[model samples]
Target: MIDLFKFFGKEESKSKDIAKERLKLVLIHDRANISPKFLDMIKDDIIKVISNYMEIEEAGLDIRLSRIPQEDDTYSTALVANIPIRRVKNMGPNRG
Candidate 1:
């Protein structure tokens, strides 16, 4: 049972979590002014391009674009993606 006496623990609270989460999100949004809808569009474009040339495992794909808070608490957003593809099976003239 949670101790009511320790209600004000030194741990992060739900409100704090919301603030931090919103802060990071707002920072990213404000820096680029890119809507979530636009982000989805970009993701689709990236997936299309990468899919055309390789049999990549979609679950392994990682794509993130965000800004880092600098000294002035202002920063630029950066796009980062990781697409891993396994080696092709066989294409040695069928060993003929």
Candidate 2:
């Protein structure tokens, strides 16, 4: 059988892509005058809130700020979150 992982791409190459994304995120944050620590705090808050309703793979979580190009040739910073949810939590009755 063919190696599917290799056919698509390897983990090592994925890491490089991740690194590039991170660099882009940093640049975006800087341009938007946002601090890295502030981003971390926001990420933590998101995880805490979402955890109440879902079982997520925190290790695979990727949160960053990105620039969305506007029609006027400008850009707006946006909060981008790529959270890997393993499953939804079974909250009883009123979703406690």
Candidate 3:
């Protein structure tokens, strides 16, 4: 039997990777002059707006700010969100 954990890297390694990613995000936020509380507020607002239309897996949601390369070789900050939607809400005839 194959060791699935080995095939997909060990849990310890995965945790380390997660830590590295979190650290990177923290640094990016600092450079962008954005606070964690502000980011959390934005995330909460996003969830509220999105939840009005569809069911979402809040636990699996991921949102971050990243730098995107531009045509002029300049980098612009962007808000990236990965929201896992479960299903769309059924809107009745009276619903807009």
Candidate 4:
């Protein structure tokens, strides 16, 4: 089975991928200067607001702050949210 899987192609090592993800999260939090509790609060609020407009895949929602480098070597923090929408709400006059 391992040989068969390798026959198709080999992917990045899981451990390395995990390490990279952990480093990214540490950097994001450090640059954003936010605590885990605060992050959770923000995530919850986002879910609430978005769910009001559309059905969302809450379990798959990914919210993070990323540092983007600028031309002058300065960095800007960006709010990155990946929310999968299932369907839009039909609120008629009050639709979002």
Candidate 4 clash figure, as a count:
0
Candidate 4 local Cα displacement, residue 38, angstroms:
0.6
Question: What is the alpha-carbon lDDT of model 1 when measured against the actual structure?
Answer: 0.74
Residue 87, candidate 4: Cα error in Å is 0.6
Check candidate 2 and list the clashing pairs: none
Q: Write the per-residue lDDT of candidate 2 for residues 7-96, one digit (tens) a residue.
A: 667877989899998898878989989899999999999999999899999999999888999999999999999999999988889766
lDDT by residue for model 1 over 1-96, one digit each (tens)? Answer: 988756865355867888997788777866788787887788889988767656677788876677766898867688778878864435367552
Q: Give candidate 2's root-mean-square deviation (CA, Å).
A: 5.7
Q: Give the higher-lDDT candidate: 2 or 4.
A: 2
Best by TM-score: 4
The alpha-carbon deviation from the true structure for residue 69 of candidate 3, after best TM-score superposition, in angstroms, is 0.9
Summing lDDT over every window of 10 consecutive residues in candidate 3, give the lowest-scoring window. Answer: 5-14
Q: Is candidate 1 or candidate 3 better by TM-score?
A: 3
Error of 3 at 50 (Å): 0.6
Per TM-score, what order, best first?
A: 4, 3, 2, 1
Clashes of each: 0, 0, 0, 0
Please list the C-alpha lDDT of all candidates, in the order they appear: 0.74, 0.92, 0.92, 0.84
- How high is the lDDT of residue 90 in model 2? 88
Candidate 3 C-alpha lDDT tens digits along 10-95: 87798999999889888789889999899999999999999999999999999999878899998777899999999999988999
Q: TM-score of each candidate?
A: 0.57, 0.72, 0.74, 0.76
The TM-score that candidate 3 achieves is 0.74
